[model samples]
Structures are given as C-alpha cells and as structure tokens.
Target chain A: MMTIERKPPLGKKVQLMATCLCDAFYDDAAVATVQVLEHLGLTVEFPQAQTCCGQPAFNAGDWAASRRVARHMVRTFKGELPVIVPSSSCAAMVFHGSLLAFEHEPDLPAVEQLARRTWELADFIVHGLGVTTWPGRFDAAIAFHRSCHTRGSNSAEAAATLMRSIPGVNLVEFGEAEQCCGFGGTFSVSFPHISEAMGRLKLQHLRAAQPQVLVGVDTSCLMHLSGLAEKEGQPVKHLHVVQVLRDALKNGGLL
Target chain B: MKFQPIDQFATTLAPEKRQSVYGGTKATHEKRTKLLAAQFAEPDHLRRLAGEIKQHAIENLDTLLPLAEERLKAGGAQVHWAVDAEAARRQVLAILQRRGATRLVKAKTMVSEEIELAPFLESHGIECLETDLGEFIIQIDHDHPSHIVRPIIHKNRREIAVSFEKNGLGAYNDEPEVITRRAREFMRKKYLAADVGMTGANFVVAESGRLVVVTNEGNSRFSLAATKCHIALVGIEKIVPRDRDLALFLNLLARSATAQQLTVYTEFIQGPKAAGQPDGPEEMHVIFVDNGRTEVLASECREILRCIRCGACMNVCPVYRQVSGHAYRSVYPGPVGAVLSPLLAGEHFLDKADLPKASSLCGACNEVCPVNIPISDLLLRLRDKGKREGAPSPGLPPMGPWALLASQPLVWKAALFCGRMLDHVPGALIPVPAFHAWTGCRTLPKWRGGEFRKWLRVRKK
Candidate 1:
C-alpha cells in the first residue's frame, strides 16, 4: 500500500496497540491500521512488549488479573506518542476501562498517562488530527456496524464521518447499526446462544441494506457477525473501516 | 429463591421465538425514544433537575415522609407507614377487612407488582381485577407481567384477542381497538361495583399531600374515583419536595416512557373527596411502604433509588430487547432491575446474583435514562462485588492464569507459538474447553506467521 502526503502540526508518531484480536485472529486489520496511519502522515511503531489490553479480565470481574495486564500495557507503551488502537473495545480498555483496572495500583499515574494518550483509530484521525476527508475511493457500497464501545466514545460519529468522506464509496445506512453485536469479550462464550442470536439479528439488518460489504470500527463485532453469517451460509463479507479507507487511499495513487 | 444461570434462563424461549415476540416492541420503543429526543428542546437540563430533586428528596426522607404524613392526616386521608413488604401487605389487608371489601379494582404500578399484592389479595378471597388493559389481559390469562410499563408486551394482539375471548369476552377480533373497548367495558363494570380501588402513585408531593398518578388509559381515574374507598400503595422513594417539582417530573416521566409531552391523564389526589366533591373516593389511604428501600439508600448503589421507574433503560437495553423481561425471573427486569433486584434482595438472594452479568455493559441504558443513573457502571460495580463475595461466573476459565500469561511476554509468546503450531491442524481438531466453546459459533483463525509480537520482532531485527 502507498502512503499519502502529511499535513504538518499533528503529532508525527503513534504507537499501534494491535489488540489481542488483531494479534491472534485479524492480522489484516493490524496491517491496515499501520498503513492507514502512515498514509495520514503519522509514523507508526509496533510495541512488541504489548499483548492484551486486560479488557477480558476486567470485564470478567477479575480486577487483579486486569491490573496485572494493564500495568504491563502502561509500562510497554510509556512514551509521548499517542497510542492508536484499531479496536474501539481495546482502545476503550486503555482509555476508560483501565481506570477501574489500576484504581489501587502504585503505577496509577502512569496508567492515567497511558489512558490520556490512548486513542481509537477513527477518533485519532478525525479529532486528534482534525482530518475527515482522506485520499480514498472504493466503488463498493459499505454498511457500518457500530460496537457498543464506539457509541459511548466520540468514535461513533468519527467512524461515520470518515467513511462518508471516501469519494466513491456508498455509505449505506441500516437500522440497529448501533446495537451491540454481542461479542462482549468473554460474553460471547459465557452466553453463546444469546451472543449468536444478537449477531444473527445484526447480520440480518446488515443484509437488509444489501451492501457489497459490512465494515465496522471494531473487528470483534465483525468476527462475531462473520462467524454467525458463515455458519448459516449467509453471503456477507466483513472488513474493518480502516482497511476500506487504507485500500482506497492506496488505490488513489497518493504516495 | 433458587439461582439459575443466565444462559439457562435465555434458553427458556428459543432465540427465534423471543425475537419474533420482542422485536416489534423494541422497534416501537426506539421510534418513541427518537421522537422524545426530537421534541424536547433541553432534555438534558430537564433530566438534571429531575435527578437533583429525587436525590435531594431521598437524602432527606426522614423529614419529607413525616411532613407528607402530617399533611395527609390534616387533609382527612389516612396515612399508614409500613417498614417492609409483609407489613405493607398486612396494612392493605387490614383496610380491606375494616371496610369489609370483597372486590378490588387496581391500576398499573410496578410497586404493587413488586409486592405481589394481587395474588395475595386473591388468595384471601377478594376478587382482584386489573383495570389497565394490558394488566387485565395478563390477569385473565394467568400470566405475570413481562415488561414493567407494558405488562403484556410479549404477546401479540392476536394472542391477546384469544386470551380475552377464552377468559370471558366472547369471540373478540384481533383489532387492538376492539379488544381495548371490550376490556374497558368489562373493567368499567368492575370499577363501578368494586368495594375498594387500589392504585400506585407516580409521585408523592409532600407539601400538598397528593398522590400523583399518570396513565394513558383513564382507568386510574376510574379506580380512584368510581369506588367508595381508594388506597394508594407507594414506595418511599417516590417523594418529591413540593407540588411545584411535579411539573419537571411529569414532563420527564411521559417523555421517557411513551414520548408524549404528558400522559393522557395526570391526576392529583389531595385527600378524600375534598369535603363534598360529588364524584371521588369517600375514604383515601396512602400506605408508604419501605420494603428494603432504606437499605438500598445506604448502599453504594444509592444512585439506583434515583430511578423513577420510567423504564427508559429497558427500552434501550440490547440484552433486554433480546431476552425480554421474564428471563430475569424477577418482578423487575432489564437494566434497572439488574441493579435493583439483587440489591433489594440482599446477599442471601442468590437467584438474582446472576442478574448483574446479564448486560453487555453497553451504556445505552445510561444514555436514554431520564434520571441519569449510571446503570452500566453500577452493573460493573455489582459484578466486582459479586466476585468479592465468591460467586465467579459459571463455566468459564478463571482469569488468574490468563492475567499471568498476559503480564509475562515470554509465556504469552510461548502460548502464541503453541497456538500457531496447533493452528495448522483444523480448529475442530483441538479439544480444549474454551477453544471448543469459541469454535462452536466462530472459526478460530489459523496461526500463519506467529502472533503480531513475533512478526513485529522479526521485522524490528
């Protein structure tokens, strides 16, 4: 993928927090996140010491475990560069969820610092850099799936605005776009039937839009929806919004 | 109460069946909420005032309750104080016994449903009738109310028509208007003939000693006016400081509940018939029920008492939209219920311990709440409290091992390497419990070039 020209006055480097989902399952999203950042004129660094965001443990009522992992994350990404996460759920874990994780830890100041610098990919692009329109064009119609975390953060509007700015992409809207896709980390396994049911409904709504692709800010939702859609032999393709935006920027020949 | 796992409760109704029954109500609720947002010029400011009023009233309940009681007594209405649900029930029975009342007409109130007053009264040989159309239908059909505000929300109009016809009304059509008319005609007779009218107040204004009741149907008016005696069963937390504060609450209640500027009827009952009003209850009784609410006030989740039972939280909740109310297996359901039920019931009530985990911690409930209760944060706190009390979630790997693996890079790398080595083999070939559970619905990604850390490490070198 080719990188676009940089507009000055924005921070130069961002440490990419490739979430456990990106690390283990959706590596393409991790690659696309880096490409997307570089294209936006930001130097991207991968901190190899990072693993999980401690969200799974935090949400599962294991504060000790969450604190242990969150402390490590704070230590690994302890720099001035903004920590950019492709997954809103993981980004939320860093920015918001980690507050609960490190409440009683001695490194609370460092954790607070990490949270202040942490930003979801869409939020960092649209708000941190004030960039809405990017060099991109995808002829395919795209429907967006919003994670519960995005709806809470500023990322909900950011993702939508960024997607709408793609010159040739058709931003298809659907009902229940903001409904949870039921991939609540451990919730998917703890309550598989309910999780799968919610995913099915989300997929059904996405299909109603009849878009060529379903894109979302979080890959966990896509993973859950895609898994359910695949099992039912439903013909639906999933892509991260970052991937869609990055692909179009590369295709625009703006290197 | 017996404890049941959430998945087991969820499986009670198949996902398809639950969706078919619940989907329409969820959509209608979403539309109503949108309309409410559009109509209100400053919803946030209105909510702030309403929340502050409730918080202040609750903080000074000792002063307010006595003032309310004194004013009610001065106005010729009897005010009875009950410390708990049993005492509250006994108070109602005593009133019925003294009046020698055999027939009862009741309107919609979650508090009444919370106390199970109808069944208790029925067992004591009083013929209790539900005057609200939804409640009436559920009563005849021998079913509990599913959704709090909309009691029979799980049933379609066709099912309701069948229930109405089979119970007593002959050969009713499925049209909602016709069913509603038939219910009104049947309930009007009960209202005119019943010895006692039982109602729930939306707000208890201390200065005026009034029980404010709001309803779309005129049944509450009929229940309070058509009978000889009226009894308003109210929770202690429903107090507002003065009659003037009602203007703010009324707007929030209707807008949050049904997206109306105000419900069709908002009646202020200030002591009996006011000394010769031709058409009002001759005797008025206000039973202030504590029912574990003081404990709720003293707990860390004191903000939960700020809930006015508007039910805006349930309407926006994705989990409630999916599973419906009965899945919680409690009088209260959805986000508010998840917080309130376990808190009210105390630690011995293990049945409701799992209720806190029912949500996805999605803040939709919080966003839509008129009183601004941080329901998602409360749920998280409850989950932590539950863990401290030694009730870990059933059927999941303990977090200790994963936390340790996550903190140490080498061990995490080793685990990733082993996962990659196993990934070349089909995912189904793995027999691990967590992996098997995950793969049941979604495919595990095959490890290609190890995890991102290893790939990034090699690139760095």
Candidate 2:
C-alpha cells in the first residue's frame, strides 16, 4: 500500500480537464480539483472548450457521432500543457478512445500524438508528476469506489495506489469493485430496472464498507449512488477523492 | 408431434406483462450476480478450464472422432456421422425406422433443434415428446424455446395454465410445482410407451466414449431409463479428452446457468443396459454430427466453439431481455448465438444482422461468460463482415452519410449545424432508417444551434 507523499516545492502550473460528468453533475468536484491543484502550490487552468470525449455515442454503436466528438475534443485541447481529468471514464475516453477512433483515419498520426498526452488525475499525480504530499490530515475511514471505467477499463491498481498514499485515510476494500455502477449513460434510462438494480447492489456494498464517504473519480456513478443514498437515507456521503485531498491540504486535517 | 415456434404463442399468451417481468427479472439477476461475485471472489477458474479443454478437443478432433466411434461400436453401440442437418435428420429417421420407434421421448438438446428433429420426425409419422418440463410446455403450445435454459422464460404461469388446458391438462394448477407435476404425469405415459429415448450429451468423454447429461428434474434419467432403445444426438464439439474434465465443467455449468452448486442429477452412460441390469435401455446408439462445426472450428471463429450451453450470457444480457430469443429465430440466441447462428446457418439469414446490433456492448456477457468469449468484439467483427460481404442488411438504410461525416470534422460540423437549425423538422426530411430505431425510443437532444467545436474556436479567439 503506497501512500501519496506531499513533497515541498509543490508550486507549479498545471491544466485541468473537467470531465463531462464533473461538469454536468458535480461542479463541486471541478472546484475541488482546482482547489487541490492550487493548494499544492500548482496553478490550475480550466479548459472551457471541452464538452465530452464522445464515449456514450461510441458505445451505442454510433461510431460516427463518437468520431465527431473525439475530433472536436482533440482540436480543442491541442497544446503542450499536461491535461488532467477528474473522472477516469473521461480520461480513458481521451487516452484510449481517441487513438481507436482515429486509428484507421487518414489523420491518425496526429490524433495518436494528442492521445499520448492525456491522463487520468490519479495517474497524473501518482505516475506522471510524482506528487505524494497532501496539505491536510484526516483520521476517518473511507472506501475507494473503483469505477468500472477506472478498474476494468482503465487500471484499478493505479487509483488504489494513489489513495493509499494519503495519510490517515483508511481505505476499505469491498466486493466486485470492478463491476459497472450501471450509470452507463443511456443504459440507465434504456434499462431502468436493471440499472437501478445494479445501482442498489453497489449501494449495498458501499453500506457494507461503512465508510464515512464514498470516493470515486466518475461523478456519473456518484450521482447515481447519491440519488439512491439520499432515498435510502444512508449516512455515507459521495465525494470525489480529489476533494478529500484538497480539504486535507488546505485545512491541515479532515474537512 | 413437432415443437412449434413459441414466439407467436408467447406474444399472444402474455404480451402485457412479458416486458416488465423480463425487465424486473434482469434487475434481480444483476443483484444475484453481485452476491454470486462476492461468494466467488476469484475469477471463474472453471471457465479457463473449459476453454483449455475445448481448445485441446478442437486440435485433436480428427483423431478423437474416430477413436470415440470405435469405442462406442465396441460397446454394442452404432455410430452415425452426419455431414449436415439434412443428413443428420435422415440418419435419425432411418434409425427410428429400423427400430419402428412410433412414439419418442426426448431430453432437452439444442442439436435436436438445430437439425429440426421434431418436425422431421413428425412428418415421417413418429410422435416426438419433450420430457423436460420447460420443453414440455413449449412442446404443448408448439413454441420454440425463448431462453436456452428456461425455454419458456417469456411466458408467465397464467399463460402456461391456458396452454396446459388447451392440451387437455385442464386440472393442472398454475403453481410451478403443480405445473411441473402435471407435465410429469402427462409425460410419464409417453416415456413408458415410447420405443426410443433421444437425448443430447452435455459432454462426451472421448477416453471412455461415455455421454454425460446433466439435468435438475430427473426427467432425462426417466426418458433414457424407461425406453427400450436409447439414441443420443451430439455435436462433435461436445467431446472432451478425459473423464476428470467433467468435474471442472460440472462445477461451473449449474452455477453459471442457474446459480446452483450442482444440478439435481448428472447421469453418465457408457453403453446400453448390460446383462442383468434392473432398468436401462436395451440397445444404445450415438450419432456424431459435424453440421458446419468443423468449418467453424477451422475458421477464425473457433472461440465460439468453447460455449458450454449454460445460457448465463443470455440471462444477464440487456438485449436478450428486450427482444427475447425468438427475434433471433435460431436454436441458439444471445451472444453465442449471434456469432454461431450466422456461421452455422449460412449468410441467407443475414436479415438477422440486427441480432448482432441488438447489444449495447456493455460487456456483461463477457464478464459472466463461462468460457470468457469476447462476445462484444466478435459481434462487432460479424457486423463489419456482414457489411463487407454485401449482405442484404435487413433492408436497413445505408450508413454512408453517418460514416462519411464522422470521418471528416468539417462535414460533421455542417451536419450538426443543419441538425440544430432544423431541430423542429417534422421527421420528414430525415429519410435515414438508421435514426428511426434511435428516435423511436427517445428524442435526439437538441443541438443548441452551434457545434461545440465552433463554440470552442470562438472562445479560443
């Protein structure tokens, strides 16, 4: 279990890509992401030009719609700055999807170059930038909700490693963390019963963990879980992992 | 009597509650899957074993087939090799003719459906009866199986009662136990009177040339035990190298199929009844049918052969829940069937190309697959193959404009602009059939009068 160390000389300029889910449901997560980046002495820039990485359309057999969205995103984010996304789903969409969509296209060489520069926030902080320090310390039990996009689709160990690094944060393990939260965008509404059923199952696991907060990178999953949690009146709160880190750094303890 | 296509019967029987029950049950299934996942934390090792065994079997199929035939023949069993479904039917009919099998009792077998055995036998004046309870209900109503495991999953109890009444079992109750008992009583006489018992083997151990059939109801045991002559119709792919392989398969088969630790009865038969046997079939025969399986094995689609017929993939599938299995119109349906049906049946049924597209590609099937087939990837490959080969495309509109627009950013932007401007277009100008299926379910989101890329460009400036 590797802990994220908060090293000195943390003041650095970084750009953040507010994932589509964060922008839509949990705008607080975006603010927290920026706050965390800045509190660590890093200047954060928000790229407003972003909309979506076009994953929903791509998964729904609408490859053309996905490509259109992918090209737009690639064109919008073309620069030398390291792009960080709060949500692993969107990050994966950018890192892996862009290359796939453009692999057979005539302009694939350029698209592949753009894809190489993208990163999920945890991966950026832990693997790329090598940041291991937080400004605050909180002594509360928390469980990391490994989103399916982050676990099966992306890499679970990477996110788990980043969380374990934060001090005083007791990360509890639950069953089937790699399974989908059933927030498959259109999948939720299309198959509402199955979607809700899957959501309830996830909620049950979260309750079983008895965590003070449920942390995940994807706000879509958080939103779905939050709705169910609110309905069930569960004590567990859903928050992005970055928010906890940001609170620890700024407040010097749990918020 | 031939088993009729159940799709029509189900549609008329319980059209109203069918969707809700299917949808509700799927939700329950997901919850069950979560619990099952917790109970079995490790990756299903049985799937890996089944995959390895199948791969070994396919590689040595040439040697194993003859070896199996020789062993069966030595044990007083006749072996018939059928090249295709037609030939398979002829061989079975010829055997029935030799034995004068007028009434036949059958255990659940997908191969029998593949060769359309019931109809062929019925047309030739032999009465075919389904012994499995689910198959019996479908048989009484002249319905094709809706799910491979549940058969009548689309039908509720009331609809089943009506079918039972229509078939002269009017005293039957709608409770599951009662209905099962009714089916058993009705089938009991047929099982005794039938001259030949027919079944499909789950796995044929090539080492001892033994056939294994697993079932919960014990109907299969009675079907084979009561009859004077027993005939087993098996696909060549069902052969495994050794006996111990059954332990690995038996572990996963029931659990994956119905979440049971083990099915109630697992019967292994090497040959017909030996001397002084209390009760068993007096004579035994095994028919090994290739029926395009060799072609499938030799082709790039060999992974499809790893299927154990557990039907877990179908139970959790979102697409199968919506359309049920009948829409695919094949003996097999859902993920495995989408790939295998086209290959086994030929390209003429390309109208079923929609079957492959029915999935959301959520990868649930792959997760629960006993053999770990990348069903979504295979389905995509089949779609691409269908398009390239100039299949009929099920009269669906061409995807040329969508494909072209997606490939080029400028063209897509223009299309988005036109779409946004004409957001209120009364669906008349949209001549594309591709959008029809989409719009039928939900309205396309309004484009907000400008493309995101164009907005980004202005903001950057």
Candidate 3:
C-alpha cells in the first residue's frame, strides 16, 4: 500500500520558490505573485537557496539527476510554511513529481513533508487564504488558458474563481478552452512544427473571443502562446493571473 | 536537429487536408463528451468500475484462460494458443491449408494489422478482402488505418472518391451516403464467395464461453454469415470474468468511441451452428495471440492491457490531431500508442523510441479514457525506460547539463548572470537549436533573470 500524507492547515507565513522559467522570462509574474500574497496578509519568504524543483530533468526521465536537485529543494525550504509557486506546472512537479523521482530514499519523509506544503498561486489565494472576493476594479476582457498540469486539480477552478472575483473583469469564453497549448517544455523544441500547429489552433480560439488579454496561471503556457502570437504578428498581451490581480488591487489601492 | 518520424509525416502532409483529418475526430470528441454528461449523472463511476473489472481479469488470467478455453472447446469450438505472432501466423496458415481455403473475408481488426495477416495470406496465393467500409478503402488504396475504430480518418471524402474512381468501385462521387453504399454493394459478393471469415473479439467471457464482437456497420456479422469457416483472432488480454461485466464495458465503450448508446450490431458467438441452426459457420476457431502482451504484462505498464480499443485517446490527443495515425508507424497510435508501441517493440525498442517523445504529456487522454488508464503517467514511465535502455533520444535536450545547473544554487546563480547576455541577442541568433525551434515561429520574452530575487531582497530590507 502507498503511504499517504495528511496536509497541514494554511498559515500566515509561506516560502516562495519562483520557477526557473519565472526567474528567466516572467519576473513580472513573480513580483505580482508576491504582491498578491502580501496583500492577503501573508508573509512571503523567498528562499535564495532554491534554484529549481528539477521538473525539466524529471520530465525528461532523468530521475537520478532530478532526485539530487529535488533533495536540494527539500533541504533548502526548511519550514512549516506552505511553498507558493506562481506556476501550477512547477507546483505539480514539487507535490506530485517529487514522489515519482524520490522512491524508497531515506529522505522521502522530508520530501513528502515539503510536498504537502506546496501550493499553486491561484489555488493558494482562493483556498489557502479563503479570499473569495477582491476589492479591485481594473477592467479588461480576457480569456483564461488552463494548462494541462492543472487538469486533475482544483487550481483551474481556483483561478476562475479569482478571475470572477475581480470587479468589472469580463471573463470571455472561447472554443476548446481545456485543450493544451502544446508547450510540453522540451516538446516545443522536440517537435516544433506540431507544437506550432497546436499553438496556432489555440490562438485561433482565443482570438475568436476578441479578448484584449490572454491570462493563465502557468508562465510556460503564457510564454508559448505569447511567443506564437508575436511571431504570427497577431500578438495579444499575455499576463499571469497574479499580475492582473495585483494590478487590479494596486489600481484600487487595496494593497 | 534530427527529424522525428511523426513531425516528419505531419509537416509533409498537405496543408489543406489538415482540417479534414481533425474535423471528424473533433466532432466525435465533442459528441462523446455531451453524451456521457447527459447519459450518466456520474459517468466516471462507470469508467472506474470498467477499469477495475478489466484489471481484475488481467490479474486472474492464469485461471481464467484455462476456464475460457475449456468452456469454449466444450461448446464445439477450437481454441489455439499462440506464444508469438509467428506462431499465430503458422497456426492460422495451417488451419487455412487444412480447410482448403482460397478466399478469405475480413472484418476490421487491429490485431490482424498487428500480425500483418492480410499481406501474409495474400503472399500465399489467397485473395483477402476487407469488408468494413473504412477498412475496405484502406485495403483498396494499399494504405493504413489512421484511427483504430475510424480506420480511414486521414483521408477526406474527395480522396476517397478519387481512390474509388481509380479502383473502379463506381464513378467519381464524394457523397458520404454514396461512398458507403458503394462499399456495401462491393462487399456483398466477397462475403458470399469467400470460404473463410476472420474477426477480432472485443470481449471473451470465461463463465459462459461467449465471444462478444461489436461494430457499427454489421460487417463482422456479414463476414461470418455465409462463410464455411470462421476464425477469431483475439488478444489474450481481451477477457472478462463474467458475462455481465459486458454491461459496464459496453456502456463506457460506445459512449467513449462514437457517442452511441449502443453499436448497431453486437454479436455473441458461443460456437458454430448449434444443432441445425439456419445460418452460421460450420467451424469456429479462436486463436489467442500473445505477441508481446505477456512481456508488457510482466513490466510496469500492465494497466494498458485494460484498453478496450475505443480510440478515445487519439481523438483528444493534441499531437494526434496534427499527425494522425500513420505517424505512429504502428497499429496503435496517439497517447496510448506513445506508451504501448515502444514497450510492445520489446527488444527492438530502439526502432520506435521516438513514439514516447512525440506527446506533450497533456493528460487529456486519461480524462477521455473509458477504462481509466493513466496514459500520461505511463508515457513518462516509457520515456524513462527509453532513456535508461540507451534508445536514441532525439527531440529531447540532454538533461544532464540541466541537472548540473539546477542542483546547486551558486552554479545556478552564475548561469543566470550569464543568461542576461541573451537579452542582447536577437531571438533568431540565439544559436541553440532548441531555443531556435521556439523562435522559428514565436518570439521570446526579454530575459529578466535574477530580477525577481533582487526585487524580493529590496522589499525585505
């Protein structure tokens, strides 16, 4: 039988592990995440000791190497605080992927302990802090893209709830809302033609909605969609959900 | 830098035909979703039960196989065990030779495609005919099935009309009903003149010795009706312990496959013409083919054996929408194919190593599965297996460098400092093929490495 861990209650203090993609291409999303958390009255701690949760290597099937990096993550964020990650894909790698790599190891308990403390940014806001409504009014028409990693979790619902909570935010609907954006990390490079084709289809649906912006919880997906849009010369402003939420809160002076 | 087989096939396909290949599948996908939502208050409950029952049958194959064989034989049918594809071919050839069979009529079966039975029989100077409409088109054109259940999904109606015109099925007509009528008329003589008939069973009941076969076109039934001898090529994994388990599987199977409450024809064959029956075959033979299934069963991917050949995975797959079936270069394709085809290759896994790497691991296949197989998880396992076994891993960058860079903070920080240099370079001049693969059709965000950390530090101070 597999061992199951009980999750602790959400607390005031939380450590942040901004994903490698966020550090490289989406620092604005990370900054927005910290602001949103701080506005919710949570102490956002950034662990400089953390680099990555080893998702790229792990997804590529290098468990031996990924486990070493995953162990570093287990050792670096040594606290009872929840680890809030802006990307749902990165959060899944920590909670779900850590188990897939670290099997029968001595520090598996520590790995499991830290996994329970991980939360996606949108999920953390709606569920962790139980903040259902936001007193912000930055209005814009936007479409939300739910990344594939967030499929079996409540993170998509959480993100949608947070979106609906923003006053004057018109959440537009489009075709094939649940389809993947084809940015499977290395998959984009591995099969660029197919990736571009998939991205083109996604863009067609999002564009049909006539949204001013494309919002999503995962920066990797946003980057892929934004890049494809820019290259196609039909670029739409793509922002993380936290960025939109933070800007709204700042516009309303609720922070 | 190397061409992945799937991407190669997809990129070379005519751009105009892309929508045709995906249009029908997308419609079926939407139909299945709506039907399941309307039919069951909790459709997932049925899917879970079916998976559990299939898994139970797989676990008890040791005892169930013998029971099914004994009951089937006792009911006036012949049961043959084949340890591999070669053994299966030999047994089938022997049976055909003894029966003096010269012409064979076939229904749609992916297993025959797996064993390459049609080509092998034709090579031996026998006329083999496919009676199913989509399959008949594939056979006439000398092409392959693009989807498992919907065989000729890759070709549009215009392509079919052209193939029909070339093969003299009729004049040039691309009407959907006309194409189907032409096939039905063409198959009538083949069924009557053919001395041997072949099919693949969807489920074999151990308790009652009943073989269940379902089809929308009633071709499987027609293939058996006028033939003197009938042969059923069954995968050993296609077994259910009780006859009633068909209720659970049938409910999920039809809805997941084509969004029907039930297929037009569902046949249950206990044995040949029982005691002066008006119309049925005189002889019935069931060849239980074990080609690579036992090998797959012994490994970590045993849950794939629970597949019901619904073709739901292919419909929902993003990669499959672009590449279709032929890209897989195997009988199975799409998300399930990505996991199964490689492991099914066994010792020759290197030959098909690129299949597992073809997917984005989007987990859509698992959601649409009637049997609740975690295909994305299995794809990851196969990728791991492929890497460990030294398969030629293309389309994937070397993870070793990433491991070194991501495992340590000091090294990672230093790399980030250097990454800022990427901001000065244009997207096209990055020189990394992986990054260039991205920029070839998309723009990259300006590098903002360490900006988040520096800001966080200032806020803390």
What TM-score does chain A reach in every model?
Answer: 0.93, 0.86, 0.95
Q: Which candidate ranks first by DockQ, i.e. highest?
A: 3
Q: Can you give the lDDT of residue B331 in candidate 3? A: 89
Instruction: For each candidate in the order shown, give its overall lDDT on alpha carbons.
Output: 0.80, 0.70, 0.87
The worst-scoring run of ten residues by lDDT in candidate 2 chain B lies at B1-10
Which regions of candidate 2 deviate over 4 angstroms? A1-151, A154-255, B1-41, B276-278, B391-461
Residues B1-461, model 2: lDDT tens digits: 11112222233434444574365447545654664576666645656667788888877999988888888877778888999999999988888899877998999999999999999899999999999888988888988887788888777788898888778886646887878777778888888888999999998888888889999988889888788888899999998888998887877777778777788999988898888879899888899888999888876668788788988788776556545777677889877888888878664646555456545455678778777776765675565555556554332333444445444545544554576444676765776543443343223433443333343355459
Best by lDDT: 3
Tens-digit lDDT track of model 3 for B1-461: 66567887889887655676689789999999999999899988888888898999998899999999999999899999998888898888888999999899998888888889989988998899998898999999999888898888888899999999999989999999999998888889889999999999999999988999999999999999999899999999999999989988888888899989999999999998888799899999999999999898898889999999999999988889888888898989988888888888878888887898888888899889999888887887787777788877666678888888887889998888789888786665676777777778888888888888888878779
Model 2 scores a C-alpha lDDT of 0.70
lDDT of 1 by residue, B70-140 (tens): 98998999999888778888899999999999999998988888888888988999998988988888889
What are the runs in model 3 whose C-alpha is more than 4 Å off? A1-6, A104-106, B426-429
What ranking of all candidate models by TM-score puts the best one first?
3, 1, 2
Candidates 1 onward: DockQ, in order? 0.47, 0.10, 0.78
- For each candidate in turn, the TM-score is 0.92, 0.72, 0.97
Better-scoring candidate (lDDT), 1 or 3: 3
